[model samples]
Target: MDELITVRFFGMVAEKLGKQELVLENPGNSDRLLEHLNENYPDLKEIKFSLAVNKKLCTEPSIIPIGAEVAILPPFSGG
Candidate 1:
């Protein structure tokens, strides 16, 4: 059996990808996952976004546990 990662896109990120969620093979870490996504979805590189692993914000390269839920979040604005 192969491990999988669940990715959820929010706001503009989802608009760019044309979907809100996806399941993919585990990419080992956050950096690898972002690389893979950028390679496959060039539009992603056009906008700034953040990564959250298992609902926690990941500011740097972090291990992605198998079956983890990752979210691609667009910049947020609050007043």
Candidate 2:
């Protein structure tokens, strides 16, 4: 069995995914996860978003442990 990772999608990303969260198998690192997602959901490639692992924003690719908490945050506009 593959390792399952819990991933949360916020704002537009969630809407695009049609679910607030997803369980992925062996997502590997942040970059690998992006690649897996992009391969599965090509639309994600065009949507600008930030990735977070274990509640911490990740600007660069990093390892994602099994069952780790991940989230994808879309661009925000605020006053």
Candidate 3:
């Protein structure tokens, strides 16, 4: 059986994609996931975002285990 990844989009990212969440075939790593997203959603390339794996922010490409939950977040601001 193939592994799956759950992706959650936030803020403008969700608005652009028109959905808040998606389930995709696991790409194995963050880099591959980004590539897939860019190919499938070209508009995402024009937007800046961050990735969090299993609720933890990732600064670099990281391995994605089976059934991982990934969150795409737009830039945040503070008052």
**TM-score, per-candidate, Cα-based:** 0.92, 0.88, 0.92
What is candidate 1's lDDT per residue for 27-57, written digit by digit as tens? 9999999999999999999999989999999
Clash count per candidate: 0, 0, 0
Best by TM-score: 1
Q: Supply the TM-score for candidate 2.
A: 0.88
Candidate 1 CA-lDDT value: 0.94
Q: What is the C-alpha RMSD of each candidate to the true structure, in Å?
A: 1.6, 1.9, 1.7
Q: Per-residue error at 58 for model 2, in Å?
A: 0.7
Instruction: Give per-residue CA lDDT, model 2, range 1-79, as digits (tens).
Output: 3488988988888888798988878668998889888998787887899999999999888999887989999997876
The residue ranges of model 2 lying beyond 4 angstroms of the native Cα positions read none
State which candidate, 2 or 3, has the greater lDDT: 3
Error in Å for residue 19 of model 2: 1.2
Give stretches of model 3 more than 4 Å off: 77-79
